[model samples]
Target: MTTEPCVAAPVRRGVAWHTPLSVAVLCAAVWLAHSHWPLLRGGAGRLAAADQGWLLLGATATLATWASAALAQQGAVPRRLPGARLVAAQFAASAANHVLPAGVGASAVNLRFLMRCGLPAARSASALAVKAAAAALVRVALIAVLAPACPGVVRLPGVSPTGAAVVAATAAGLVLLLCGPLRPRCRRALAAVGGDLRAVHARPGRAAALWGGSLAFAALHALVLVAVARSVELPLPPARVALLYVAASTAAALLPTPGGLGSLDAALVLALAAAGAPGATAASTVLGYRLLTVWLPLVPGLLVLGVLVRRRAL
Candidate 1:
């Protein structure tokens, strides 16, 4: 008699845990959105019917952001993923990001999705890290390139010594933890990530997709903000607005808030105000941005997440 592999049992158990937990999380998210529906409606009331056309354009840009993310994710790994399913996964992941802090929800969904696609957890996680690192680098490059074009548009407050020390300590601790106790697995994962990164760079198609998608992702997000700014009649030029968005997003990245909820909103409003947008316009722009990117697609995104969970696609 042949004994079944030990991995099979745990894989099966994981499905059991994953499905219920995902469904529960989806339910909780929908319930939370429902409780906040009145606030969303109030925010929506701010937009004028005259600006509906630009708002629709913003919505289209938001949709494209998910597709760009999927493309970038696919490029991070050598393997080809089914396009439709991968895009769906990104959509679900975006929705998940709003509910969990610092993208934990989205990362969990994507990790599970990659596993279902036959990637081991280590490779999947490596792919994720690669994608994140690439995207972040591209974002910083964009800011560096654009900041000069719009001088005085982006103002960064000086970092306090305490904050600098805290960041340095955190990085040092992480380095120690990885090199000391977690060296073996960390080494393996880093090796796989390095190999994949090298392979992605060698192939023109994958390289273009990775870098292009990342650039497009940041640009599309900025476009959404620009569109919102226009809709609210914010006084800043498009270039200034984009730079302000990039600056605010970079600052907000330091905070682990879910979907950059409070932190991002505050940073954006402050940035816009600093860039010469009236206070009311800045606030409205933030509200409209959140409405399109977060509140509007939330319920449908949660539904897709639940369906994917039940189907074991995540």
Candidate 2:
């Protein structure tokens, strides 16, 4: 009888916190949209003057990205997931992704969905790690293939001795920090991920789906940027734009910003400018890209998230 109150107390506390967290997430979304309204408004005006056909192409590519993501996610685990729900979860996860740094929100949403699908927690986490590793590998591969086609599009910045030392010191510090308290846990997690990775690769169909979906997701994103550039009539070649998009996105991953917001925007603008686009055109291309990828789908994505939660799908 005494344990009942103790258990009920935690449940009540969880309910209390969950309500506020939901409210906070909604409020943050509104605030973010409100803050970016001016930029979106101005970008809309610019897009209004641009080529609608290219913009439509960009939007279509944007829609295709979510499907690619769902495919990659399914390939991460061996279990069969409901196709429609998986796609819906990915769509909702994209919206949630913008609310937190370094893909936390999206990861959380997917993690929950995976758990609800009946996978053990450890396996589910390993699946996520596998998916991320596949995505990273695919991004690097794309960059390597595309970079050669667009000579001089990406130039290596020379790091001074002091800057190199600082970077090395920062990396060493992070390594030591992580190694201290989390070493054992990290080791166990890595082992689990390695096991899952091997199990996944043992099946040729799963391996193909994982790599193919990852490649498609990255390619589609690059295509969206290329289409946006075309819409704005940016002078850069399509190949060059695609190369710059992949390279810039890879570099921006180092920044822990929510959905690569500021980091990606800045990297892309600079990349386009370096590739010979006029400053105004470069900015316009980024704005249009963001409009299709982030802002336009945000509200609807959130609505889907709410429905998923209500239906207990996530």
True-structure RMSD, every candidate: 4.6, 5.7
The sequence of per-residue lDDT tens digits that candidate 1 reaches over residues 1-314 is 11122121125654377667767867777697879988797888897542898899999999999999998997887777878889999999998998899989889989988888877888789889989989999989989999899987766669999999999999999999998989998888889889889988888888888988888999999999999988878888998888888878878878999988899999999888877778988999999998888898888888889888776677
Task: Write model 2 residue lDDT over 67-122, tens digit each, in one string.
Answer: 99999988888767778888999999999988789899899999988887877789
Q: What is the lDDT of residue 187 in candidate 2?
A: 91
Positional deviation of residue 265's Cα in model 1 after best superposition, in angstroms: 0.5
The lDDT of model 1 is: 0.85
Residue 63 Cα positional deviation in candidate 2, in Å, after optimal superposition: 0.6
Q: Per-prediction count of colliding residue pairs?
A: 0, 0
lDDT score, candidate 1, position 290: 88
In model 2, the runs with Cα more than 4 Å from the true position are 1-27, 174-181
Worst-scoring 10-residue span by lDDT in model 2: 1-10
